[model samples]
Target: MTVLRGRGVSLSAATEGGERAVSIDVEAYYRRYGPQVLRRCRFLLRDEEKAVDAMHDVFVQLLRYQGALKDAAPSSLLHRIATTVCLNRLRGAKRRPEDREDELVLQIASADDTESRTAARGLLDRLFGRVPASSQDIAVLHLVDGMTLEETAREVGLSVSGVRKRLRALTAVLQELELEAA
Candidate 1:
């Protein structure tokens, strides 16, 4: 087997469909996107340990989808994968007795105004819950995390205009919700 270096990882290239193809370099992926993934997990889970675990889980998942991921944009795809992983973990926590304690702790430790934070998180959950998963990722990356529009677009694999349009529509809906609440 021949070894190929990709950002400090060794990957063996293989032939598929009579074309030379490269495998996913887990280490390279980690080196490039690990901190960002960790941040996403931490932002959602609000627990240092769980965030680390979630980041690891996402990489493990990347291994399973390595072939398909070879053609993907690493950052955008990883961001989406991290979001899905964190969301799944959150959902799973709700169903597990042991994890429930951790969830409660995370909720409480997330902010001083626990009630307002919970309400805001709930509102976001409901708002993004009604949209496509990509939209949720965009909202979290842009509005919640305060990433610029260009950054959010690049991370989400959308054109700037496309992301702008989505944000505008999302803002309108949120404004309507605010009006109704008021």
Candidate 2:
């Protein structure tokens, strides 16, 4: 019996001296990794439906590239593929700036109490509106989504240092806004 390097499965040699590779159980693989892949894709794509499509595409790509993944860690491979798939989906698509603004507004509108929620929404709207569009996007991707600076850079097609600078600028603007509001 010979075991595949990273797949954690063993296969027996055939009578004719050929090693028969075990068939991939795609469903089991999906079941194990589906949620993780979906979460990563959703973080990158932001749209639930687009994230689902990207998840499916990632799985398909994984199946097609199974041979190459024989020696790679499955989780790392899945994350890398999911990130690439999401970035590809984002590349050709035109995102509506208003949609993102509305989404952020809605998130701010959902706080615990009605009065606080309204105040938060109003503050966020004013602050975000005053900031440059690029800064708003970076702020949302980094602060709201809890994405790392590297992930934000990947999503926004910015360098890590560029993202860091943008985030710092945004923070300064937010601080000024908070002081003015107070």
Candidate 3:
């Protein structure tokens, strides 16, 4: 008997004329790679809920290209697919209302510090309102969310170097604002 694999690879009877073929356990593959895929997606997406969506999208794409995944390097392949999914979602998304709500929540949450927190909140609100929307998102992702430059790049579809340049520009603006206030 002969069998055709999903990737179009074939296997025939193991005889003098046939070579033995190795089989992959798909369940094991999923178990082994699932956490890593989620982590990568989370790093790229920033938001926990959106990251879960991205992870699901990555798995769906992987299932669609099962044969290719079998042949390709899983980590790199998954990373590329996950990054693409995250970028697409980000590009399609508008400025979320939850972001503003979250910022307010953070401000309220920080009120435990009273006076200094009030000053910081005022400063941040003024500064953030002055920046472009995309720049503000990048800044919040990096500074408040504690994402690395590479992670911010993946989320915002910028190169790490480009993110660095933008961060520097933002920092300079913040310094000037601070000096003026002083």
lDDT of each: 0.74, 0.71, 0.68
lDDT of 1 by residue, 1-182 (tens): 46667554555665655665568778788988999999999999999999999999999998888866664578888888999999998987664323232333354346668687888677666666666778768766765566877898999999978886776666666656667779
Name the top lDDT candidate.
Answer: 1
* List of clashing residue pairs for candidate 2: none
Please give the ranking of all candidate structures by lDDT, highest first, separated by commas: 1, 2, 3
Q: Please write out the lDDT profile of model 3 over residues 36-153, one tens digit for every residue.
A: 8788878877888878878888877866766444544667777788889888877754422223334543664477667978887887777667776777888779767868778999
Q: Which residue ranges in model 3 land beyond 4 Å of their true spot? A: 1-26, 68-70, 94-182
Residue pairs clashing in model 1 are none
Clash pairs (backbone) in predicted model 3:
none
Structural similarity to truth (TM-score) of each candidate: 0.47, 0.42, 0.39
Best by TM-score: 1
Please give the range of 10 consecutive residues that has the lowest summed lDDT in model 1: 96-105
* Model 2 lDDT, residue 110, Cα: 69
